[model samples]
Target: MTEQKQETKCITLKGSAVLLKEYLLYGINSILYQRGIYPPETFEPAEQFGLCILMSTDPKIKNFFDNVLGQIQEWLIQRIVEKVTLVILNVNTKEVLEKWDFKVDYETVSSNGNADDNGDGKFIEVGSKDTKTIQKEIREVIRQITGTVSFLPLLDCLCSFDILTYTKPECDIPKDWDETDPVFIANSQEVKLRSFSTSIHKMDTIVSYRNT
Candidate 1:
């Protein structure tokens, strides 16, 4: 008897957009917990992407992430966002200590749309990829995120994090969004981590820390 091959299906643009947003949210939360940016007790371990992941349970933190990821999803669908950066800084000195850069690539989207454009312009047909395969890739990225603690410097001082999105120059900025300069680390060491793609979108992860 021959084994039957499972058929793969292409996800819709809307579905891909949601998946990408969730990935970013979870990835940020994972980094926050792993880097000891917040109290470990504030997060609870939960199963996701075939791995036990820690997620923030505090109401204020949850709400903030919701608002940020909501707007990010909007930009993602329109394919205007180029990169999402998580900047960790020393609260006292207001100096950047570490940076987690998630570079985004819209594999099947057009480049002609403005940031204010709401309509889906020149839709690219998404190719088929197995859901399990995507999950496996995500699991690997998560493992890398967790392992980064071994190399990253100890954040002995008080620290805070800021989320920044790099978008097209023509993209309209919301009232809540303000222009800010990129927070770069001095004498930094960078490490490139594993990346995963959902056929329609690809995200590459990089971490830069202040070399002590």
Candidate 2:
């Protein structure tokens, strides 16, 4: 039996930027243009989006293009997004940013308006530490982000998206999926979390989780 060589293309930062451009602009611009706030002819989704990211990387390269192609991220969120996510998948460009970097990253600087959370604001604290509440809040965030991204035309432009979602009603995860979270063994082979939500998060081990 001979295995065929897989024609896999490298996942680079450029690919991520390309996807980001579409997901961040077209859907938002289309709605804004219909609202008559921004002129129809002036609303160049692809070009504007491409220029925004390009401007961030190299403002000098665009020369005078920077003046016409000002970055507009907050506008997109204000017009078309109830929620937003910055997904980075390595495909072409070499310099990938660190985790949680986008949490504070912004294209347009606000005029003495805010410095904390980069204007995203702190997540509201929901009372009750029950597992149901945790799951509900997480699911709500997921629902919002998914809804936002569904309008994006370039969702298929990704090699893969690695995710870790945990859900359980007494361990009510997807039952048929024959996948288990990674675990490690110590001297006590039969070790378990002493109680629900009582275990410490380890560097390289799955910790048991519960609402209580």
Candidate 3:
């Protein structure tokens, strides 16, 4: 009974992927709200990671995240996604202003779910960390994101946002996916935030803004 109870607490690759997707969902919404890309009234408060997160109520924005992050979850399980970026830019001039990057690193998982010498370098089916602890780490990252508004320069012009996902070169690009040049901010200043690991995948976040 003890072993069975402990087994239920194991974090699997799919579970980690789901958690990653949720973090992106909440993090992006928080960015949108904090940066004032959308009107503050368009978002509603919701509880996540023990924090009151403001999620977008706009149907279009909601659907966009659902579809994009849904696909990202699958790729994460496959260990193919490299990074996901949220780019904020001026709507009129189309100049890039700020970028938030979520970088992923794949970790080796043992076959028996134990980190033993006998296990070969493959994939982690069952991870080592518990869900509760991971959520706590996520809470801190989100808190830092909210605090960034204090230092990040104001967007004086009308602005909009877009999400970009970087994948391994051999990844199978979906027919609906279009290739685009990488977005960059000239004379950018970057700040790295705290990282969280699921024992299967490690995530690091960095935010860069044009030093105007």
Candidate 4:
């Protein structure tokens, strides 16, 4: 019998960005459901990253994420985005209640000639790691976010969430998007969640809340 060879998985920049965007999409949905930003009945059960996740069914909310994450994916491909934050605030007082920061780091690509090299002597960043491993890591991060309800302070007031994308200074800002000051939680308690990497890009997540 002939020996079987394992097929190599090649991860390009565009593929990496798509994976990151998917994580953000499901991750934000999980947060909204767990934090009670909307009525529990408004969300429906969905499966992602091998976990049953609750996703928002509200049309406005769904539209919001689609637009925001779309721009973010482009930035991720250009390696211009720094962090994407989901800020939870009191609708009445505009007080920041919680902040979830998804920080991005571009992995260094080796210059040594390999399969990733183009004919022009320039190397394209490529990830050889299997997608299954990356998805497993994402699963753990989502699980941690779900577990945060245990220790996080109850958001008793009406709360709203805004997504902020931090990009490099050289990055061009879209006309529809305005520059806003970063939100911070006063006297905060922070918990860093497990991070996942696609070999081309590494992501770290941290959640902060007001200390009471």
**Predicted candidate 3 versus true structure: per-residue lDDT over 1-212, tens digit per residue:** 99977775688888899999999999999999999999999999999999999999999999999889999999998889999999999998999999999999998765554553346755447877889889989999999999999999998789999999999987887788787878999999999999998888899999999997
In order, candidate lDDTs are: 0.83, 0.25, 0.91, 0.89
lDDT of 4 by residue, 68-181 (tens): 999999999899999999999999999999999999999964333444434676565667666788899999999999999999999999999999999999998889998999
- Superposing all C-alpha atoms, what RMSD in Å does each candidate have to the true structure? 4.9, 24.0, 4.2, 3.0
lDDT of 1 at 204: 96
lDDT for 119 (candidate 2): 52
lDDT of 2 by residue, 172-210 (tens): 323433444422222211111111110110011111111
Ranking by TM-score: 3, 4, 1, 2
Candidate order (lDDT): 3, 4, 1, 2
Worst 10 residues of 4 by lDDT: 1-10
Output the lDDT of residue 179, model 1.
Answer: 93
Whose TM-score is higher: candidate 1's or candidate 2's?
1
Off by over 4 Å in 2: 1-9, 41-212
Q: Give the TM-score of candidate 2.
A: 0.21
Candidate 1: residue 96 Cα off by (Å): 0.4
In model 1, the Cα lDDT at residue 190 comes to 94
lDDT of 4 at 22: 96
Please list the residue runs of candidate 3 whose C-alpha ends up more than 4 Å from where it truly belongs after superposition.
113-124
